[model samples]
Target: MEQPHFKSWPDVAPTLIAVAAGRAPADTVIRGGQWVNVHTREILPDHDIAIAQGRVAFVGPDASHCIGEGTEIIEADGRFMIPGLCDGHMHIESGMLTPAEFARAVIPHGTTSMFTDPHEIANVLGLDGVRMMHDEALMQPVNIFTQMPSCAPSAPGLETTGYEITPDDVAEAMTWPGIIGLGEMMNFPGVIHADPKMLAEIAATQRAGKTVGGHYASPDLGPDFAAYVAGGPADDHEGTCEADAIARVRQGMRSMMRLGSAWYDVETQITAVTEKGLDPRNFILCTDDSHSGTLVNDGHMNRVLRHAISCGCDPLIALQMATINTATHFGLEREIGSITPGRRADIILTSNLTDLPIEHVIARGKTVAMDGKVMVDCPHLDWPDHARRTVNLGPARRAEDFVITAPEGANRVTANVIGVVENQAPTKALTADLDVIDGAVAGDADKDICQIALVERHLGTGKTVNGFVSGFGYTGDMAIASSVAHDSHHMIVVGTSRDDMAKAANRLGEVGGGITVFKDGQEIAMVELPIAGLMSDSPVSEVAAKAQDMVDAMAACGCHLNNAYMQHSLLALVVIPELRISDLGLVDVTKFELTDVIKGSA
Candidate 1:
């Protein structure tokens, strides 16, 4: 893997000293800006920042002494000079775009730093996919650090991933140039229970002197949370409430409040710092998973910043949460977090702090974006043919393949259902009473209950597990299926009609890997994610347009939930939930065991 931070402080220390002392001319200078100093939580007007060798050399009231004819001077025009926004945690694959395309989409939005977990690809293509993502991320002008994915199946026996990450893989990835830490330890139960495999991965990361990311999804902040924290994870982005945030920060973990496409967690959690008067340094801002449409239409980290500010956080404090707090947590504070001397020149010029308008962005002392247009190249790696052909359905599925059989002779059954929670990651484990027709369970469209299945796309096993779901409010003989199922990367199909479900799953298999929506057995809209069956290498604009169409198609089917596609894709995420479907069966995540979809007679 290639290194993104090319200029070490030692490499430019002499030049920096010279420029600071006015002994040499600066390479670039941003003059007459109101510096939003995150270090002191203050905004100072009439400041100038001088850059040399892609690193800031001087930040003071005047840099005219270091100016020369060759020096490129940018007038900030009394704008707020904030550090380039940083996403403390995110997944590039969730956007249905590769690292290069994700970079292209977010650069103009003023996101210069990202801490990305590539577990979506890891579950599909393993270490090779992770290395590919890391390599492409380094090619971009901004800072995109890769966290070696710690879990593949996520919950060990609850689900089976296409590729499992091993302890040796974790250790090996730590030595890579771009890897900042171990990815979110999704198996919090494994940590609490002292699972050998989970401990070994955590030990390897610690031995390599890197951070261990965390995901404690349970609402319990008691003994389980303490045990998981003791297992060596450093930060958590799964916090959704004030208590969750406070409990995390109190235990020395940075509470990463996020606002993703479907996850609206920041407003609920930011109160730990704003209202509770806790130290804001331990609070971080992130987009845990923003899809292509969210990235192109709404901003990236800037969106989180504006939301945090709207939630009553001070603007400077919110910037700190998105920038320095993130960099400091990952031990990159000295390199790329701020505009201080000897740091990477990743700065943003905005006309205002509230409702930040990214007028211009500079990453590594160069003008990478201006007025919502990327001016630099975001490069792509040559993905192999095998990565494109990962979806292996074994054989075409039939409508009969998705039927949920009721217990023998039972006319009615109480079925466990996965309930979609709007604007959140966790789903409610609900149960519904439904009728059994021809010994098969039937979904009640009026009750908003529908059939859900996990199609085993890896290993060509021709296996599937059927279940039920609710809260999407879908109707009119529609089905939506995605190969981008969380953690396992299996194909999750949900629909009112078994035939339409079959059609949607077959459509993805026919295209190798992608998301497709079907109504009355006809394909309505689709987004082809041919890479690892999770993301596409296409330009973000094209993918976003197609994703919007998919959203529209879902709406046409009478389904309405904010980013329902995201909720649909996570139907099989066995790690973080109350109930989920896996290749084996319907998993009761609270118990971490497979339960029959059909219970006793209703």
Candidate 2:
């Protein structure tokens, strides 16, 4: 029952105006640049930006008016001075690194702002877990806003979470200093139907005057979609096509296009702007989820921007999408989006607008990254021992835990298999026929069938749900296991060999929590995700190296799907379509009901 110190936008307005009028000594100044003004969608040449006390002061031909003694000046060399990129929606835990490490990984890529939802951790450790992430995010130099996780189990009764988020929790979080809004309301069905709980959360966010994030995973744009919009989510990031983008914007929602480690959605959706010529301001760019490997090896928002350009989006338009569009969506536009007066001094200097190689990065009027490297120290949180020790398998797992028994007297049976779709989150509802061996249903690798298991890791529960999956092209004697399963964050292990699968699963239990790959009952690779059994405390490069080895191990096993590990982990996500598994049982995602894993007919 304590209130935190809060600073509203109006409180900083006076200081900003004083800085702009040259009445205050500028803290930093960037000289001789072409300013990319996203506010008016115009490029102003020969602009000089002056900063004071971590806020933009003046932007004009010359900030000679505000220049004072000892002011640090950065020569832009006539390059494009653009606002630092903002990921409209993302998951820091997906990087398999803590927020500190994730920030260190993306700073060089010029992402100064992020709006993240820690639903994965919420499903694992609940509100305390969310608070850990929220506190750590605030300690960083860049802007990182926490949207109170709207869904813990994701889909109400379809899956059970370690802890459930209540409407009271949502109301309490709205009072937090860092709570920007509600996290993505993944319950599209509940929203459309006006579910009381969902409506209450939205009403709480509205009462607090904050934004509500959206996730309409279904491609259906009919009356249901209209009903969802009427329920009050202001933005959506699940759009994969131009039509999806256009429809969301048409219904008074900002269209968020994402390009994550394995998800290539921006290129397909940005065409709504470049070719079809939809208003670019309504679209925002994000990397929804990127692993540490992708964060270190490739880039963050920079990668999204590059893919947007290849898709024919004008460079400035793409920059705008990554900047002001995101800021405005979160109601932080005047506070930090544009590099204008009365905004946070978050700016990036690039040599070429088209290529966009980030040269200098500044956040809060301080040089944070320079020459493709982080210049400032990204702070870390003091994660307690219990926080890292989250994988709670009641006892050691055994091969017998994976055996699936078919219905009585059934020699062979057809089963509903969760099909892994490469490079996308959704799975296909695939059915496979399998033969019974010794009264137990077995996976048929020759038929491209493999076993999928969801292990209950929260609260020392020994529940394990075993099912089947396909489309990995996996051949003989291999298995993959991950503690990074989506939403619920349980351990999901998939393999052609039961012994290898058990080895991979047991290895994670031994290491506290992490991902492991095995071949013929021998471990080949592992990445230690000790933080809530979902992210690594290790450096991005070290984690990326292990991730690469894990990928290579999957390739050696004859599985040829792109980032198949990501797809495999999502098999238990009951929210996404077709079929999925959870701690309870196999989920018929389409109907949002539990279905028998064994097939009655072909």
Q: Point to the candidate with the largest lDDT.
A: 1
Instruction: Give the runs in model 2 whose Cα sits over 4 Å from its true position.
Output: 1-15
List pairs with backbone clashes in candidate 2: none
lDDT of 2 by residue, 167-210 (tens): 89899899998899999999988998999999999999999999
Tell me the TM-score of each prediction against the true structure: 0.99, 0.96
TM-score, predicted candidate 2 vs. hidden true structure: 0.96
Please state every model's RMSD to the true fold in angstroms.
Answer: 1.0, 2.1
- Expressed as tens digits, the lDDT of each residue in 136-205 for candidate 1 is 8988888899999999979888888888999999999999888999999999999999999999999999
The local distance difference test score of each candidate is: 0.92, 0.87
> Which structure among the candidates has the greatest TM-score?
1
TM-score between candidate 1 and the true structure: 0.99
